[model samples]
Every structure is written in C-alpha cells, then in structure tokens.
Target: MTAIITTTSSATDTATLEPGAEAPANAGEAAAAASEAGAGAPALTGEHTDLLETLARHRFFLRFTTKDLTDEQAAARTTVSELTLGGLVKHVALTERRWMDFVVRGGEAFANGFSEREAEFRLVEGETLAGVLARYEEVARRTEEIVAGIPDLGAGHPLPEAPWFEPGASWSARRVLLHLIAETSQHAGHADIIRESLDGARTMG
Candidate 1:
C-alpha cells in the first residue's frame, strides 16, 4: 500500500498523519468543522455563481486523475469495488454531454448510443486516467461555450423523450447551466471523500 502524509494546522496546534490515515469518524464533527469554517463567508452572487463556486471548490479532486495512482487507489475501496476519480471524471463528462445533447440540443436519445449511462462508474481496461481527465475537460469547456451562446432563459426547446419535459416546455439556458453545476458539485463531494481515503491527501486544501 502507498502512503501520503497530511497536516492539519490551526493557530496553535498541528497534527500529522501517516500514509494510511482514517478520517475523523464522527460525521457530526466533520460537519461542524466545515460549518464553522464557512460561517463568515459572504452571500453568493446568484444561482449561477453559487453553483459554479461550489463546483470550482471541488476541482482539486479532478487533479487526482493525473496523479500517480491506479484505479484502486483512486477509488479507495477494496470490496464491492466500483468507483474512482478517473471514473468520476468520465461519468461527469458523459453526464454533461447527455444533458447538453439530449435536454438542451434535443437530439437522439443517448440511451440508444450508450446502453448504460451509469457505466461511467466502472473504469474500462485500456482507458488511461489522463485520457479520461482530458475528455472531461473538453466536455466541460464545450458545455461552457454552449451556455455562453444562449441568450434567453425562457426559450422553449422540444424534449421528445422526456416525459416531464413536454414538447413546448421552455427553460432558460441559465437554468440548465446552473443545474449542471449543481450536479457536478454534488459528485465532486463524493470524489473528495474517495480521494482522501485513497492516499490521505486532503481534497479541500
């Protein structure tokens, strides 16, 4: 097993961990710490700003895709194994593609092209971590470009397959961007915990 050291520093105290470290087991304690740290933060600008800020904060976890680690190391799991930083990047890329392609672009259903959307959770053989990360960046950039091109939030787009999205259902492009940001931010939290367990490398700082 490989190891990495992490240091937690405060005004007057410092603590160190060995390569294989167990995070504080108390969930409440962890939540409390995070809440205390965020207490004085100013109000967020808007829905888009709030969501984008959340996603940017977790970009550190994406760095693991380029780090020297195997699929197992990225996942930090031994049993019922299925999760990795690379896999998460792939998943996010596919997710962004699906939302933009299907929901926004109103194209052919991805389900026909990729039978299992959740396959992103499994790392396929021959797929390098670097390649996955690169693809993720590409998709993210494209999504941003598409979002920038949209000028109206009330524009109606056809959703041929979405039951809830009726043919005339309209949504602002801003709403879609915010939704994607929220989704990515949620997954980034998952990546943070998985990465920390993998090598004791803290994702937050």
Candidate 2:
C-alpha cells in the first residue's frame, strides 16, 4: 500500500475567504516551494496573474449557476446523467482540494481512496446547497493560498500509478494549475446545461 502523507495542515495558517469573497492580497503566485515561504512568497508574474484571473472567471460561472437555487432545485437532476448543480459544486470543491493536496504532498495525496470522488457528487442526507458552496469557497481560498506561497512552478512530482496517467510521467505545479482551470471550466459548462434545464437559466447570453 502507498504511504499517506498529510499536507492538509499547511493551510492551517492561511486565512479563509468568505462566500463570494475576492482573492486575498497574496493570491496567484504559482510555483511549488523550493523551501517553505508561506505568506512571504514572491509577487505574481504576468503568467501567474493571468492563470489566476482565468481560474477565477470560470469559478464565478460555476458558482453563478447555483445562484437563487433552493436546496431541492440544486439537488434535482436536470439531465439524464446523475449530474446536479449542487453536486457539481461539491465535486469541483473536492477536485480542487485534492489537487492542492497533491501540490503540497505529491502522489501520496491519493492514499485517501476513491470513495470521496463519488460521494461528493451528491447532496447526501441533510446536506444543503449553502453548505456545499461554503466548502467550495474554502477550497478555492486554500488553492489560492497554496499557489501564492509555493516558490517553483517548475517543480514536479511523479504521477500517481493509475490507468488514466502515463507511466513515469510527472507534472509541474504549473501543469496542475492549468488542469484545475480546465477541470473547473468543463464542469462549469456542464453546470450551465443543468441550470438551463432546471429553470431556463443560462450562465451566458
């Protein structure tokens, strides 16, 4: 079995953003640490700034899809697939959290198992739309904090041993950020469809 290394504690010192809050003062510094830097990480460059802006834009769309929705409406499956507005928000939060963990802890991030991947897609009993959105905001804030503190976007770790990943290949922190943006964007589109189906709401004109 692969060893599980804990990286969640790294974010303990970072400040949390409230729901719909803007990125913190230190947001968008993309690069893994060559050594611990925390709040003292270097200022953002054009690339990192652009990356964060694009990510924030897509994130806005994703969250906006759930606007004005009741828990029941958010949980309703509008498409043939199991996808729902609340579920998409929850899943995106989970995905972002895990990838940030990988950035800090590397391949050991997967040690938690795949069960979380499935469960986050639905609002389990007693779960609310407000709750999931709050969690997503927390995750997003953590991502910004992690990215802003790390010192080397060029730093990489070997890919986890999975069928979906190429053997022996690795990804830099930059790659991971791009992947996050893409993942969020894709899901945001799916969310648009679901929202439109639910009440003819579209993310765009």
Candidate 3:
C-alpha cells in the first residue's frame, strides 16, 4: 500500500508513524512502522498465548460461517464448488488435528498422499454439522493446551512427502500456528461465500 509521504502532504488523515517522522515510502518502512506500533502494545505472556490469540481470531470467522445454518443447509452445495459449510468445518478440524500431529509427532505421523486426501474436504454421511462443530471445538481446546505446554515455539519437523506442501521444508511450531491461521482464513472465506449463497446470510456485515 502507498503510505503518506509527509505530515503536510495530506490533510484528510494523518498516517501514524513515528513522532514527527515522515510516512513510509516502501514495504520495509511500512513494516518497520507497524513493528514499532505493535511494540507499544501490551506484551504477551508467551508464544502460546500469542499463537492461541491468532488462532482464535481466524477461528471466529470460520465458525461464524456455520452459525445459524441447518444441517441440510450446511451440507447443501450452494456454489459450483463441492465445498459446504459443514464440510469446511470438518476440513479445518481435521487439518488442525493433522498439523498438531506434525507438531507433536513428525514425518511418521500420517504417511498418505493426495489419492487418500480428497475425502477430507467433504461432509460425508453421518457427519452432522453440529457433530463436526463439536469436534472442531475439541480440537481447538486441545491445541491451546498443547501450545501452552511447549517449551518454545521453535520446535518443528520436516514436512512429509506431500504434493501440496513446499518441497524440502521444515516448519517450526511457530510456523505451524501461522499455517493454522492460513488454513482457517482461506476456508473461512470459502465458507462465507457458500453460506451467503445457501441463504441471504453473511458471516460479516
């Protein structure tokens, strides 16, 4: 994003940079300003608290997408894609459980491939929306507990041989939390769209 050049450059709104400092002109400067501002925010007690906070933020959006929807509505294919609100809920929960396995265990966790992974993105029979939601809640609570007990956020394991993940990369526990954020956020958007199509409902105003 383009930042304000100078305090005198604009009168509509003053961009908050350092005191008497000119606004950033580049991404690096913008990041620096943001870091400075964030530094002034209250310090988090630990990485677990920080990670859980982020996880909870994205989780809210995802869960909102499923709110007030009937089991049939959640399973309905409101969009051309196979995604449904219930399916997305199930998918994200399984994702968290799998990633948690990666965090606790390593490459040996679930040695499977794409050929066996497509089922995850579907709300199969017997998996009600409420049931899936409860499962996700359990996973969320368990994840917070796991994160709270970690020594540090630096723990990690090499990624498995999967076609989807980046090749030859190891993810730190911190990165795992970031991945969780991405997982929930991307699906949250999809879920929101599906939810709106299913009815006139929206996850956000």
The candidate maximizing TM-score is 2
lDDT of 1 by residue, 9-56 (tens): 121012233345432332233323433544564323354334333443
Instruction: Give me the runs in candidate 3 sitting further than 4 Å from their true place.
Output: 1-44, 113-116
Residue range 1-205, candidate 2, lDDT tens digits? 0001111222312433233332323222211221133345444656666666567667766776776789999999988989999999999889989988999999999886667876789999999999998888678767777777767788989989999999999988899999999999899889988887887766533
What order do candidates take by TM-score, descending? 2, 3, 1
Prediction RMSDs, each to the true structure: 9.8, 9.3, 12.5
TM-score of 2: 0.78
TM-score for each of the candidates: 0.61, 0.78, 0.74
* Cα-based lDDT at residue 196, candidate 3: 71
**lDDT at 116 for candidate 1?**
55
Clashes of 2: 3
Task: Please write out the lDDT profile of model 3 over residues 36-114, one tens digit for every residue.
Answer: 4445543335556656666665666676666556788888998889988888888888889888888898876666533
- Rank by lDDT, highest first: 2, 3, 1
Enumerate clash totals for all models, in the order shown.
1, 3, 0
Best lDDT among the predictions, by candidate number: 2
Each model's lDDT: 0.51, 0.71, 0.67
RMSD (Cα, Å) of candidate 2? 9.3
Minimal lDDT window, size 10, model 3: 1-10
